[model samples]
Target: MQPIFRVQSNLLYQRLEDALQQGLELRLVTQGDRFCGVPIALDEEFIEILYLHVSEDEDSPEEDPYARTVWVIRIAEILAVAYQQSWSRDKLAQLLPTDAATSEVEES
Candidate 1:
């Protein structure tokens, strides 16, 4: 997974909301070093996650290698969301186009 963006704790919900509205997939990593898949649902206290994993060996047709599952957790557990470096709003804002920068100023 590529490291793209890091959202501050205070901005986490707003960033997640924007991502959800844009139909973006986000991989959430916890402080415990666990990868808790894409967020499929969220609430004030918890978030529902969906993760996919594929087995390395293709030994038997009966043994399905692909697996998907959901995990739910409180917001306090999350540490970061994996994203492409270029897509990081906080990091890339200084490099934005003039018009976009203008819009940012307007928003502020």
Candidate 2:
């Protein structure tokens, strides 16, 4: 059966998109960092719910764009999100670059 099309109540997407649109860099801790567009498009499942896509960008001392791309991830693996705090300069420094704002987060 086709999933119902609905507006995502995901405050995450709203915030991120707003930040991005306003040219503010958002620090997202995800698996993959790149996507065809948004990790999930409109009318897709998980609408209104903030679903995390694993970013491909693994922060290394070396530059790796492939590591930073974003992909849909399982809910089980996420330990946390940037809910209460932003990434540290150290954390931000470690992130690989996919766009103007995103940085690398090396695997722990």
lDDT (10s digit) by residue, model 1, range 1-108: 532333345588666666556556677778676654666786656667778888776566546778998888676677887543245666567798879977997898
Q: What is the TM-score of each candidate against the true structure?
A: 0.55, 0.27
* Each prediction's number of clashing residue pairs: 3, 29
Which RMSD values do the candidates have, in order? Answer: 10.6, 14.0
Estimate, for each residue in 31-78, the C-alpha lDDT of model 2 and write its tens digit. 653222233322233311233445454664344333333444332232
lDDT score at residue 24, model 2, on the 0-100 scale: 43
lDDT of 2 at 60: 48
